[model samples]
Target: MTDRTVTVAEAGESAVLDVLSGEPADVGDDPVGNGDDAAVLGPAAATVVTTDMLVEGTHFRLDVTNWSDLGRRAVAQNVSDVLAMGADCTRILVALAVPGHTTMADIADLSEGIHGEAARSGALVVGGDLTRADVVVVGITAIGTLPYGHAPVRLDGARPGDRIGLTGLPGCSAAGLALLLDGRGDGPLQQAHRVPTTPIGSGAAARRAGATSLTDVSDGLLRDLAALARASGVAADLDGGALPVHPDLRQAAADLGATDIDARVLDWMLDGGEDHGLLGTFPPGVDVPPEFTIIGRVRAGEPGLVTLDGVPRIPGGWDSARGAN
Candidate 1:
């Protein structure tokens, strides 16, 4: 195979930025270059900001994913937070800490991935800094804007009588992760683990449909939803049978040689993290979006109480200090 590695000096920070931001000479609405110290954003009724970091061996592994996919994942995760607020991401800042062994082509591919994701989300990459490290690290900060007369959706907004719904697949990433660990799954399963994509537009759709509260599944579904319930001081009861467990999860379990594949898949759906799917609570009588599936409903109970089929759901999830998987 041809060598694709390059030293920091060989790649040069400016060259990498050029690759990501487009030719330095071409000026867009907000030109991305080494000159600007900060990005000037449009005046909006409300602004929402969130940041996330991905470190080697923690959030990802170089052996399992490529630079381009990693870049996309780094952006996608931060965007998820913005989406949770029921706002649209307008811009992002990307910072990198790369080891000496990382290649120039690697950075180029990563930049391409970031640019592609930003375009898909209708966001721009404005600025960032490059630094040295023993391993690859990505830090992304996403800025979002809400329309006039709209407010950022908060976890505390959920109330009794609200309906709970979810957009897209929740357990695919976790199942993909299992496949990766088993080292016996196909490319798609491994791809989901490396760079899972969320339905970025679902947040706006939820807002339009009068969602009372919203959250993204960065952590396991139960864990994150439990936090939302705690913040709202209510209970979230989920129908165990209502979960939209992706078909791929069952296949992944079988591929991993699990005896009770159905039960294992259920476990992954409840406890798996990093799917980036959006979960929201809507006020009673409000119409949920077509993209969403009604999984359960909100009710009065002990604060932070989350149950699956009337039984208390076990608390197990992704911990930054401890691996989520």
Candidate 2:
């Protein structure tokens, strides 16, 4: 069905709450959710806050994804930051600025996506605002608490000789984007880019295993890892052979009938973004959680440098202000 344009008056605060269906957070002091001017949340032993926004035509496109996916992806972006800090998100605040022509049903779908993903992460919806804009921009703020230990993981703690591990697949969403651009829509690989999933439980697992540093692969493996390396003041030696490539990329390549599929797939793994996978450094001899696949090691070398199979990996990452790589 085609979406209808919804006005700010028609999609009021009550309508927004009804669309969410009380699916957001329930742990806060303001249990009623979305009626008052502000929300009150519980005090934490250590609380972490993160905010991320997804703008149409920049972070996403309406032609490829529906409003529901948009909402979920927006929430996912915020959650990944908390998870990167080695915490589980406890609540979310969603602010939506939509075009005047947007439909009420579309708003509902967006709320459904946000609430659904938050529920999956065991996070509740707190409160936010709906304002008018020329285009769609979904801003989400995630509040998280350290679940496993005294301190949340940071990007600056990695040491030389530490093992580098990644908690989820990195290239799936990139492959999905490739498939979508190649006109294969609605397939599994294509959907990966539309509503990409992350390893939700791995943050706590990494904390339990005493992860020294952590961050998620948002911009690209090398790009994000390079940031981690710079933060930790160490070198990250990535193993090209050890990096796990999702088979879907190869499948997409086969379907596209492309030459040099292996090299192209490697490019996607190396430079793609939006995967939401956690990458971290662990102490030597520490047993990484089962979900982590060791793809590299922190070693003595140039600080903030990353190498793949001992060769320096040049940065050709996705730059939002410029364009996707």
Candidate 3:
């Protein structure tokens, strides 16, 4: 019998190196594992770092989502976090774990998707690692820089009498998911599920407009608003009637025999995670930007949430590892 040995170079190390050096666009002066075991970094104005992971069965279904959409979503969500903090994304580092059965072309296409989305947000993909796993998992760590003399907005600053607002419509992604799960063909709802359209600049705009607290509505609007309220030691009151429901979602729900579009929209908007819209609270009398709509108000309380219509919204918030599944 003969024994064979496998080396890192033979097991895709060279392929990884090629991606780092050749595949992505121009590599700037930044030192990225060329020689030393560590990549060096210089001081910058402000540094904002965020990390997010997408699991296979939970965050995405390989059969339903394309490599390009997956890549764009991973980078876009992380960028949403930086924007939530009123920062401009600079670069991202990705870590991928995939089953050995995955094709090289899929991996390459995914990388291209990441590169394209990062570029759209004015960020670059700096580096990453790859490894074998039982399922496909993508982790992205994004770093951003805030403008000179500006502070990152945080959830703890919301105050009583502040107006709660949201940028753009909600429940589109969730509705889209429902449509796809129902075997609906390609359409607006399905597109919403595949690609969430986040308001890229609203975070910074809110900050400049004197927002006291802010967060991206990745996990339903009500749930994230609850988080902001908890962090700020206030109570959030959302006017249920004031929410913006995508027109397509309304039509799709009707087509799918969904009895109450309002309930469905509310469920997705308040507890259906992954929308990536910006939710914020501004002090009274502050001029909110045109992109945002006033959805509710902030009040003094035991760091909890409520509905402006005097009702308790859905429980079991958008927990990816729990509720959504």
TM-scores for candidates 1 onward, in order: 0.93, 0.93, 0.90
lDDT string, candidate 1, 221-296, tens digits: 9988999999999998998888886767777788788899888888788888888889899998888888888999
- The clash count of every prediction, one per candidate, is 1, 8, 1
Clashing residue pairs for model 1: 6-103
Best-fitting candidate, measured by TM-score? 1
Can you tell me which runs of candidate 2 are displaced by over 4 Å?
Answer: 1-14, 17-25, 28-33, 147-149
lDDT of 2: 0.82
In candidate 1, stretches whose alpha carbon ends up further than 4 angstroms from where it belongs are 1-5, 23-35
Candidate 2 clashing pairs, residues 3+ apart or interchain: 4-103, 5-102, 6-102, 6-103, 24-124, 24-125, 25-124, 25-125
Worst 10 residues of 1 by lDDT: 25-34
Better of 2 and 3 by TM-score: 2
lDDT of 2 by residue, 1-325 (tens): 2223555456665665556545433455544565467877665778899988888878888988998888888888788888888898888898888876677778778888998888888788877877778989998999989743479899899999999999767777888887787777878767778886867878878988999999988898989999899988888899988988776778787787779889778888888888888999999888899899999999877888999898998866687678775
What residue pairs are clashing in model 3?
A: 218-274
lDDT of each: 0.82, 0.82, 0.78
